[model samples]
Target: MGIHLHKLALVGAIALGAFGLAACGSGSSDSEGGATGVENPTPVGGSWEKGNFLPVSTFTDRCVSPRSGTDPITGSAYADVLGTRQDENNWLRSMSNELYLWYDEIEDKDPARFDSSLTYFEELRTFALTPSGREKDRFHFTEPTNEWLSQSESGIYIGYGVQWALISSEPPRKALVAYLDQEDSSLPDAITRGAEVISVDGVDLANGSDVDTLNEGMWPAKSGESHEFKILPLGASDPVTVTLVSAEVESDPVQHVKVETTDSDRKVGYMLFNDHIAKAEGELIDAITELESEGIDDLILDLRYNGGGYLDIAAELAYMIAGDNSVGQSFEHMQFNDQHPEINPVTGAPLDPTPFHTSALGLADDSLKGYPLPTLNLPRLFVLTSGNTCSASEAIINGLRGVDVEVIQIGETTCGKPYGFYPLDNCGTTYFTIQFSGANAKGFGEYSDGFVPNGPFGTEADLPGCEVDDDFDHLLGDVNEARFAAALNYIEGGDCGDVAVKAFAEFGTSNRLLESNVSVPKEISRSNRIMVR
Candidate 1:
């Protein structure tokens, strides 16, 4: 998905690690300790407690480092002021007080106390817990506007064209190629899926003490940066030394589109969708058009590594899948804070249902805005997931289910996120504070603990499907792969794969694997919940 990262608007403040339904570790730790108590309501015409007197506009666009030139992506001149860092902090506090979904729960601390706007912004989330005692708000984060804008320049990021699956982050740590960037073909052919990183820049990958060197080489700082790696290709006996030159890489959301014939002679389409970026609209339209032409009986939408992007794109994809069933239904009923129960806090529009988009709303290309989307007219959809399946990706599952389109989840539980935000840029930093919580048509979207597989199904509680571990040995889209095979088997006769593997893939094992998984980059780690206004 492209905040401008696509997921937070495509990628805004949702910076965090990647794993199965595990708790996303964010930098909101400074907000803990509860020393700052909750804010009390103010009289109708008066100010609230704890310095909540001023409006967010008083500090808007006031940055410590103001820009004077035109922005390359937006092609608009910046309107920044030579203001102090405290101005930025005041902006975050006032803005949070106005638009945050949990404004009342937040501890109203002083904006002038913290030196940096980042540390101050982190303290703006609620300290409330879920029914399970988990933190209610886990998606608060921020990134420099310059860094985010650079990626937005062309929806490109500089890297080795590899999405590494951190099977183990610590020693004897194991990192495998989850998948290669389908958008980049310049990467060496030897660096295919399942390839193992034995060493990075001569530093041993597994059990390497210098994580900094390994990380630097694994994720190059800039384009044209050269890094060496001793990689053991998939199924190879020995490792081979290769140089990985970083380049400006863009992610391809729709990849590995294939139509498979089952034993019953039924046609099933498998589309590995990785992001909800704008371009993905065209890519997905093309993919669905092909599948629809073939008259496929079923669709397996793989969203294992998807972190979400444009919500509109997600709605379009849902319409493409469910067709008339969700044509006029509420894709999501979004609600903001109590102060503005009937109006969207961010857009200031009267609160209304986000309809399951019938025609393309053109996120990728303005030319395709009103074009009708091609649909498989599927009654049931199969999803391949992992912890990486998040936000906009989760929205697909929830939205489809809202219209009673059967979703058979075939993998670990998803990253439960029923919240979305419009990435708001203030004074050189884009903040991703939770602005709204969404519910499906049946009034269900409280999945903060994620959707569990094998839980009581048909109740919108937990999704129904086979629970299996991710098989990295075989390439994705391969029917023999654990999750894919399970999906195929389920379609054949509702058969779930090996009991032993299913048992092993449950709670304890999933958590253990997640605990060892790799931490992603701050800028690129998080997917988006893009409010594309």
Candidate 2:
């Protein structure tokens, strides 16, 4: 049988939201009762006995019968399945067996933490090949509940509906409401952006002992969980206590899109792209078409908070930005494990590099079918970023650079992740293991430590363009906002003058330690991901 392409639609809770499957050919094995006389080998202990290990095992049943037991401490019945501690060793072995890169580097971990499945998973990833000390291969997780996966894929969440930032780590730790999800109209008007979080669950934030309580209140596991918070409004001196109940919230990925005329008579298109979901593609196309009609001189893509989503959308966006200049060029190259260098493990076919997509995929109907992508066709592009910019968002920068397009990056370094996976649902939990590493047309994919700003950080190499700290004082999209101002200044042929290079010192070591001690929450803070399908 001929190999057919299969797309994997894995959605991350935090960063890159969606991913498209690579050009992998899927075909039946001759040994599986096909015309060929070759016999198929049996799988043992999650290891493949014959043929290509990855794709073959991926499609075949490779899992061994899990051991069962009872938890001594909790007296709960447990099965040694995918999410149990008894399967820790097998899980690690399986990850090492299939991970695209760094599999050989995984160290043997102790299985004693089997009582705590999440901790065991963490220990399993401790040996990942982290060249720059910043863990890029550290997204392996088991959700407390399966609903999180569906919620993430649908761009709906259950939380307080506020994105917060730890503003200070001094004696009195301070957190500020960075932004609010307006779609969650259930939130009180007093809980607007820039509001100060004074206390959570009656635990004063100034007290060092309250960190644990604060984190729990902020990231509750279930919807309808209520937490009492004392917040100081943006301009208020008195504090008001409010009990906020978590609820399911729908998000709008394209927060803002407009055409702005700079002081120098340049018609610039600005788009605040926050998430990469199904909805974003149409929004982006509409924005681009509008800008093209307005005869815009340049475009500014604000992805400072975009965690990433949908590789196809990323390619589409790149095509819209570069237009004809990108045709006939490789958009991205997916590199699977060493065993399958030229073949797609998922499809069992010769690997074909992904090219710049000219048309939208996965649309409901002909509304966007064969719609010609609008392009800025500018030689250079300005992208505003922060540590949160990741995955498919980075793909945009890398894909553009591969085609010799100038990408002027401003703000902080990105959460360097060039790896992606097809999320696997085993038992009751979703597992994300790096299955492929991506490269641009130029074959440059060595950004594991992350893409640094203007200068290099440790082993991470510096990217093209200057770096500037985020101006938190000014609202995002404002002309005076430090990052935006820096981009605008560069557009006007000016330089960032005397901009202080300050580290984001919100979460101190103690606070970080406290956070780690807590149980891993179902919701993730950053969605560092690449989804296929």
Best by TM-score: 1
Candidate 1 global lDDT: 0.71
Model 2 worst lDDT window (10 residues): 13-22
Per-residue alpha-carbon lDDT of model 2 for 23-131, expressed as tens digits?
A: 1111111112212232332323343232222232232221222223542212454332222223333443444455436555555544433444344445545354566
Candidate maximizing lDDT: 1
TM-scores for all candidates? 0.87, 0.77
lDDT of 1 by residue, 35-57 (tens): 22323211121333584446655
Query: C-alpha displacement of 288 in model 2, angstroms?
Result: 2.4
Q: Supply candidate 2's per-residue lDDT for 41.
A: 29
**What's the TM for model 2?**
0.77
Each prediction's RMSD over C-alphas, in Å, is: 7.1, 9.9
